[model samples]
Target chain A: MAVILITGGARSGKSRRAEMRTRAFPGQPVYVATAEALDTEMEARIAKHRARRGADWIEREVPLDLVGALVATDGGGARLVDCLTLWLSNLMHATRDWEREVTELAAALPRFKSPVVLVTNEVGLGIVPDNALARLYRDAAGTMNQTIADVADEVEFVVAGLPMKLK
Target chain B: MAVILITGGARSGKSRRAEMRTRAFPGQPVYVATAEALDTEMEARIAKHRARRGADWIEREVPLDLVGALVATDGGGARLVDCLTLWLSNLMHATRDWEREVTELAAALPRFKSPVVLVTNEVGLGIVPDNALARLYRDAAGTMNQTIADVADEVEFVVAGLPMKLK
Candidate 1:
């Protein structure tokens, strides 16, 4: 089992790159979407991603319980967790202990029998947000990224549709 | 002379990396600062950077007119533009034509006799900003980065105090 982390800024082609990596592995690909189409903006974005990723993937909308979803979908093809940031947001919104959830996911990643490619955003690279919540979220996001990247077998930082290997 | 672009998220150690690059060139390194300490938060950050950078280098505070400043300091050692994001924000606040300024800077970079090391932020990697102004700024920052990167001889994306060469 291989745990690969792909991190980048918004629209940096991280999802596309992760899709390519996930497809390179054998078996039917799994698209573990952490995003739920809550609004038109999100719906449109999800549609766009699906259109590009094709319909062959076994899609699973696992917004919060990512570890459980991955566990249930084990022994299959590569699992591409389209993102972890949104999952964090969802956990926070649901009043779940995000830190614990993130830790659990990191702990479970190495034990998986199938390949897992996780996509994440680099949110803390910009100007500090004015609101305290945004600040907290960015900090949490950065910490989560570091933790996952540390546990992964490989890590890549993407920019302008290019992936620069970090590990 | 080489034009190098170092980009990353907030607190990603971009300044340290840029400083090392600037020192690699011969002569007294010039620190071209685009930041103005208008508030306590900024003042603290500026102080920290100055402490790390040391007082041995020649420093210039040029929030706007970066191209002119670079041209004026042509024969000096490598000029490190501490950041382009603040410069962009300053231009936007001053009602200056930022796109034109960025274009001019890009065009003028190759002609500089001194090596130039620029630091910039990747603001668009996180979730879409709730405010329209932040969104516009992030979009502008992204475009500016890509434009500058296209002209840069070397481009590096820093993450968690690590630099990953993009070019």
Candidate 2:
């Protein structure tokens, strides 16, 4: 019924807020995780998150091809993409065209029949990165956020584990 | 007349929002900068900000002794402390009692009769810092923000160059 975008820095309650929003919809909830357990710490973190989510959620891990997976859903229930930033990072490492991908995702969002609560991290709010790659990633993340926010029906900023609705 | 908490990451339009808020009050605006230009890059950034602020502001560079500097103000005009994180960093480096200082600052806030706009950064939203010092700094920043936000009349979170009022 709506597209909600929740963005904040790492561990800013964006995911928790997005998870809670899924309850407002009908049928089972879909949890699309963009993060890959590439490292031991990350694997542990992912497990912890999944544990918190419980068995009720239909979990799908999509490191790439996010748009395809999202669109492939039957629009049967509320879908929560645990994060777009990690997905963006995955795409970045794959040397894919991020701009085109972002454009595609934003364009495809409104077509979803059920509400899709998206979680994302805003990483560009820190000091100007010291390296070129970090700077490039920061710029891409900022643009990606703007593109998605422009289309989302509701946008929020999380601070200190609190959600502040922006739109 | 009000205490507005402006919290965001670096370069997130926080300073700009704080600057605009200063216009709503009586008398001149006071700019309390806690950042010390210890490096060439920092010096350049400080100069750029000072130029943007223009010559009208009564600029006070308070690297430490934030509460004292604040209390010493004549309670006239809008006061902006364009970041508490920097001040905290200064205290952290000095091995001072930051918790006590934070408590004192919060206690002293209500005494400022006119509007006081405070700027701060949120550094805890990312992955757990790889280093102990970074982690400590991040935790300190979060606690400090909460301490001040609890006392402030209003709090806003800025993301993607926009502000969302939280209180």
Candidate 3:
């Protein structure tokens, strides 16, 4: 069993890189997408991403409650959590239960049986945003990354379509 | 002489990490800031950042012409280019020959006598932006980072307040 955490800056090809690493595991793949189409633009983006996947893979559109989504996956199945940052953003905008949700999300990663690769956006290197909400999201994402990276069996930082192992 | 490129997601402590790495060099330091305070919020941010630095640094507030800014530094001065993304953004908004400017900027690195640390934000790891300008900026930043990282003697990716050497 492997819990691989993949992180990188926006559009650094993190999702493609994360998916590539999951190929070593022998099972029907599960793509656990954490994005919701709140707007037409986002819906189009989601549709574009979804169209690129292989036909046989199972898809789970999980906006939040990642713990519950993970519980339903097969232990031997290769599960790809397309991203965690968006889910964090979703929670940040919704009810103020993000801390509890993040803790539960971290605790649930260990329950997977085979290989599970997680994709998380690295958004902390730019100027600190002027708004309080953006800062809160940044802090929350950083904390979640550290927590997941700690428990991950492998960690990689993707840049310019390449993967640099961090742990 | 050493050309070091430092990159990370926004607010990932890339700037501070870059300045810290330059401490080993024995020379007067240069902090070449590429940001322009076009608005009140930005002006406040710039003032706050400037307040954090010690008085000894040779501060060069160069907004667009990075190559010219570097050319003015002392040969042995420890140059810390606080950022490249804002410079790129500024160029995008301005009517100027950016390609030529970038070429010159890359060519100026070898002329430095001591360590020169360049900090850049990785903005390509998130969803593809819905707007054209954002997409253009993202692509431009990625290209610029790759361009610098190629010529730099060393490159590092910072995350969650930690530095991980990439090359």
Candidate 4:
């Protein structure tokens, strides 16, 4: 049971690389998407991403409660969470009890039966945000990434669409 | 002091409708976005939404603590939350203490000072999901919508891009 955490900067091709890595595992790939299309442009973008996913990919669009989603996919062979950064952002945007949620996700990861690839963004490299809310997001995302990274068996950083093995 | 709760199915043009409604108010609008782009597609979606918003619109992308976001926008006029379903979904996905987050959000709505529009999705309209996670999302979304509708001064349901006033 290997849980891999993939992190990178924006437009760093982290998702693409993560998807490619999923193919190396034995069973059919399960993709857990953290996206919700709120507009036409987003709808179009979602369409494009869907088109790109391999024919063998089983798509599960769960905008909330990924631990539940993961539990439901208990028999999965290979699982890939396209991005943890968005999950973190979504958590930061919705719940007041963020710390508890992070703790829950951390505890839930080890229970997965299959090889898991968790994707996230490196928010610490960017300039510090001016507003309190932005600062909060940056801090929360950075912390969540750190926590997830500590749990996974392997942690990889993608830069300019290139994957660099960190651990 | 109207407190409107806008609920609809996905891609139902509710956000655009909310934007138009906010413009009818006197002061500049406050757009509270609860989304963060975690991939290329999401980044594009965020950019597109940003393009549509005017300079007068004070954009605050609050991902987690919506009650706190509403509190900050207390004196700000015509506050429009792009969508609460997404926010609720985010909280559920991220936090272990989802009950507490939901309670806080429900408790904070009435305390809002300016006229507010709460945007969310009507997830109860769909068929029951096959799995436990999907069922949980459906149930949680239904509960959150019911809670907001109970306190809102006006509730509107959007279908095929048309708004039907409920209250």
Candidate 5:
């Protein structure tokens, strides 16, 4: 299995770029979503995303156990994790052992049957949060992205919807 | 059902307070975790939270279909959703229609057979984000908390581990 990690700031068009990259793979692509719509505006936001993705991708809304989903779908075609920051945030909000899950994901990647493209936001460039939770999220996502990058066969940083290969 | 919404910054003791408040309710209290550990530090953090929660609470890790889980667990006992911001973040990351889930949650609240304590972070109090996605998350979460508060029987804001009843 081959793993690629993608990172960029919010709305840098990382997801769109990741989508385009994943479609090049030989098999049908699977999109693992980590978002939950909680309001009207969010409803509209989700609608926009759906309109963009269309119906080609087999979508799985695995917000919490992305690792498990990734492992299960490892043999499928190409797999794209839309964003890791939201996944990290979800981990912080509910589970206590988010680190273990990350570890498991890293360990399981090489064994997976399909090529993987992991999408995440680079959160360290921003100012330190004033509160504990924000700070925790910032640090955690930063570290998680770093770990994924370290293991990934390719690392790309997106800027203004442009992808720049770092490794 | 007696529904209360808790809002706070990270580590402001919202979880602790939610736990304490739910302790007042009879029967087994349920902790609906939305987190997925993806790294070492996050694993440690999850472990710490687990230690604090002990084995008394029946834990259900529901990262995506939270409203459905809430619906299924309604009559079981008191339910505590550790945080809404993370839930919303998950929705935003995965699907485009996170608002549908929010509306479903709001609609499901009154029919809950047990008291529900919905916890969320007050992220909008801080400065606006520099990008579109961050700004979207902030705006969506803020609006979500407000909508949940409007429906809750009691609403509280937590700062530095202290809770101030807002409504």
Candidate 6:
């Protein structure tokens, strides 16, 4: 089973690219959303993504415990983890150990039975933030992206709706 | 002449990559810096870049008038504009029209006698900024990147110190 990691900036078409990759694999596509509609903005974004993805996907909202969710959905069609950065945020907000969890996910990715296409953001590519929290989060994001990309069989960095193969 | 655009996140080795490209050209390399040492942090970063690049190259700190600098340095060896995003920031801060300047830079790139290697940050990949100004800057950066990349002879999206060719 192939583990593909698609990364890019905001509105850089990472989700669309991931969906196309997930659909390329055999079986029904599973959309594992890491985002929870915590606010109107998020709810609206979720709705837009749902509209774009259509109703065919077997959707699951697993804000945290991604490894467990992946395990539960292993035997099905390719699982598209719509994003990992939001998952990291969720973990941090929940006081979960993000570094350990990221490492665990990286370890679990190789043994998956079904193809997995994960999307993540490249958050560190901007000016250094003014706050310490932002700095920490961006560093964590960069580390997480590098770790997952190392284990994934394929990696793509998307920009302006175009995907460039990184691995 | 080749006009290369190297875009990546902060500390993503874009300057190092640009230096390599510039050095590959035949004559003495010109380092067109868009940064002014306004703060100690900036001064340190600029010093680090200079240390890494060595002292053999000609350097010019043209924070706003990039097109003018390029035109003035036209017939020399490859000119490495060690970034465009910072230049864009300077333009916006100076109340100059960035879109028009970016378009002008694109138009001027093709006419240069020497090669140009420009570095830029991919600032819009992260979570939406909390402030409107940050959001506006990111949007501006995204548009500028896309516009410049459209005319670039070579475009690379770098991550984790690795280069991924986009064009």
Q: TM-scores across all candidates?
A: 0.62, 0.61, 0.59, 0.49, 0.52, 0.61
lDDT tens per residue, model 5, B101-138: 78878888978889998888777654567777888877
Comparing 1 with 3 on TM-score, the higher-scoring candidate is 1
Classify candidate 1 by CAPRI docking class.
acceptable
Among residues 3 or more apart in sequence or in different chains, the pairs in candidate 1 whose N, CA or C atoms overlap within 3 Å are A9-B125, A10-B124, A10-B125, A125-B9, A125-B10
Give the Cα error of residue B120 in candidate 6, in Å. 8.8
Residue A56 CA displacement from its true place in model 1, Å: 2.3
Candidate 1, residue B4: Cα displacement in angstroms equals 9.1
Q: Over 4 Å off in model 4, which ranges?
A: B1-167
Q: In candidate 3, what are the lDDT values of residues A1-167, reduced to their tens digit?
A: 78999998765667777777876678888899999778885787678767766677788999887778888885757889989898888788777598888787678777667678999988766667777777777888889999999889999987855579889
> Who wins the DockQ comparison?
1
Q: What is the lDDT of residue B113 in candidate 5?
A: 85
lDDT, candidate 6, at A150:
93
Per-residue lDDT tens digits of candidate 6, residues B1-167?
89899988888888999999899999999999999999999999999999999999999999999999999999989999978889999999999999899999989999999999999988786656998787778877877887788788889878788998888
| Residue B105, model 6: Cα distance from true site in angstroms | 17
Candidate 4 residue pairs in backbone clash: A65-B93, A84-A119, A92-B63, A92-B64, A93-B63, A93-B64, A94-B63, A94-B64, A101-B95, A101-B96
Q: For each candidate, what is chain B's TM-score?
A: 0.98, 0.97, 0.93, 0.92, 0.96, 0.98
Misplaced by over 4 Å in model 3 are: B1-121, B124-132, B143-167
Docking class of 5: incorrect
Clash list (residue pairs), candidate 6: A9-B125, A10-B125, A125-B9
Error of 5 at A27 (Å): 79
lDDT of 2 by residue, B32-71 (tens): 8999889999999899988888899998899988877777
Best prediction by lDDT? 1
For each candidate, what's the DockQ?
A: 0.25, 0.19, 0.19, 0.01, 0.02, 0.25
Give candidate 6 regions above 4 Å deviation: B1-121, B125-128, B136-165
As for TM-score, the candidate ahead, 5 or 6, is: 6
Clashes of 1: 5
Native interface contacts kept by each candidate, as a fraction: 0.40, 0.25, 0.29, 0.00, 0.00, 0.38
Candidate 5 deviant stretches above 4 angstroms? A1-167
